[model samples]
Target: MKLTVLVDNNTYIDQYYAGEPAVSYYIEIDDLKILFDTGYSHIFIKNAVSMGIDLNAVTHIVLSHGHNDHSRGLKYLREQYALPNARLVAHPLCFRPKSYENEYIGAPFSLEEINRLFCYQPAEAPVFLSENCIFLGQIPELYSFEKRKAIGTTIIDGAEREDLCLDDSALVCRTDQGLFIVTGCSHSGICSITDHARKVCQDQRITGIIGGFHLFDTDSKLEETIRFLSDLSPDMLYPCHCVSLKAKAQMLKYMDIEEVGVGLTIQL
Candidate 1:
């Protein structure tokens, strides 16, 4: 599998690609070309073009969650390219209207519009896009500390209710060595997501993990998460987007963390 960072919150000094407070990754596994998340705006599209990646060639568009920073780029992608054959894979509630403290922070397009545009495949169960790549749907809270906390509100069935981010998920790629996890903002708790991925993939060994952990402080949760990850001992860790530098530094105390930025590529 080959993965390229199309958009991220950081960029290498000489990479020249534009940076944004978002997340998007272009992944190629076997014959499949998968796009994970879309970032905040046209920045992903711009970075993709500059990185020599053709959006139109994407075979799958996967959303890790419904947050704007992770999914709002769909509008720009639709305007700039035509990916008629690409199938959209995400949780059923991912397209529902979402807001945090009265501010809209959901995907730019509605589920109806998405259905019409691409081969929409709403999943609440693990679905395999290919032999090795699987979308972990509706991550379960497997640990007591990583309990689900309502972020804000979401409109469902004409009624607004607390959004526990049940739609939040991640992608697990099975490799010869172990599982490689890709995620957007892990509102469902990074450890919970990893546990669910292990359950779904039936693989205990984690080769690596990339994308946001939604961790920002040096609290008990962060310490516990670091311990959990340290136990797994993945070869590499690329925690970006919602993760703060302090949290990264704390993690570095126990495990190795790779610097992630736009134009960065990883081959596994």
Candidate 2:
């Protein structure tokens, strides 16, 4: 595997990366080097070192919720990347208290500021960061009609949240070209995060499904999310941060779609 798109929202308009948006994404299976979510600041560490990407070889940092353009790039990767031991597979209530109320608001910039340099492995459903990846937490809603709406549930400095408890997750690999979904904004509802990553990576074939499908999909959640991704008939389907454009034209009207922007690159 090998994925790039060091930041998105649509930019990388050819001609050598013109303009930018930075939403972060930089996976690389086998000797893994994940870093899915850390944009909107140092612009995903300066477009991931100009697309050569190697921020101290991050091991993991899969946070898909606690919005703020996805954890506000942990304040420019705690002041210009270095990792020292990067490991932050989220879902321990994804740092509680969120916002988006009157539109795009937030909370989650404490804990001495994201532990200064990330490392908080809290999960809920499936853990394992190796043996062929797997970091999906709290993605156990099991769709059945997907419904998770917590745009912003406040109450900090004393706990108590409303539960957008999104703690969103995704990162399932079984390679050799099979189940390899890796989201960060499907927000626990991209067919219930690919049917809970095929029942916690029991795997059954699903080659690609990259990041962010969050745009509050419609048209029947985009026709039951493409009939559950055409029965996991994956083979590549990378979306990007806060998917929109009318929920990706209702998921490209049910299949065939790929475009993550910002230095887009992918392999498997």
Candidate 3:
């Protein structure tokens, strides 16, 4: 499997690709071309073109959650590529209307528009997109330190309720070494997501993890999270997007954390 960072919150000093406070990863596994979480704007498209990646060939577009930063790029993506054959995969609630403090923070497209644009696959259970890649559906709470937290309100059946981000999920790629996890903001909690990935894949070893951890302050939760990750001892960790530098600094004391940026590529 190979993965390319099409959009991220940072860019290396010499690398000239665009950056945004968002996430978008282009992954190739087996014969499948998957795009995980479009960024907040058209930056993903620009970065992809710079990387010489043909977005039109993407076979699957998987959304990590309904948050705008993770999913709003769909509007820009459709403008350049038809992607008639690609399938849209995400939790059923990922396309609903969501807001935080009276500001929209959901996918740019609605469920109806998504259904009309591509082959939509609403999955609440783990679904294998390829022999080595599996889209982890709704993550279950597996850790006490990392519990589901509400970010905003989402409309369900015409009623608004606190969004626990039940739609948030991740993708796991199985390899000889272990599992390589690709996630969005990890509103579901990175440790919880990792545990769920291990349970679903039935593998204890994790080779690496990339994408947002949503950890900010260097609080007790960060300490416990670092301990939890230290126990797993994954080969590498690339926590970006919503993860704060202070949290990254705290994590650096215990584990290997790679710097993620646009134009970064990893082959495994």
What would the TM-scores of all predictions be? 0.98, 0.32, 0.98
| Clash pairs, model 3 backbone | none
Pairs clashing in candidate 1? none
Residue-level lDDT tens digits of model 1 in 1-268: 9999999999999789999999999999978999999999899988889988888899999999999999999999888778888999999999999999989999999989988887999999999898899999998887777788898999999999999998999999989889999999998888988888888888898999999999998998899999999998998889999999999999999999999999999898
Least accurate stretch of 10 residues (summed lDDT) in model 2? Answer: 13-22
Q: Across residues 71-168, which tens digit of lDDT does each residue of candidate 3 receive?
A: 89999988888888899999999999999999999999889998888799999999999878999999998877778888889999999999999999
Order the candidates by TM-score, highest first: 3, 1, 2
Q: Would you list the clashing residue pairs of candidate 2?
A: 7-23, 7-24, 8-23
Local distance difference test values of all predictions, in order: 0.92, 0.71, 0.92
So what's the TM-score on candidate 2? 0.32
Error of 3 at 189 (Å): 1.1
Task: Name the lDDT value of residue 32 in candidate 3.
Answer: 93
Model 3 C-alpha lDDT versus the unseen true structure:
0.92
User: Regarding lDDT, does 1 or 2 come out ahead?
Assistant: 1
Q: Which stretches of candidate 1 lie over 4 Å from their true place?
A: none
* Candidate 1: residue 102 lDDT (0-100): 89
Q: Which runs in model 2 stand beyond 4 Å of their true positions? A: 2-26, 29-32, 35-56, 66-93, 97-110, 118-144, 149-159, 166-180, 184-187, 192-207, 210-226, 236-267
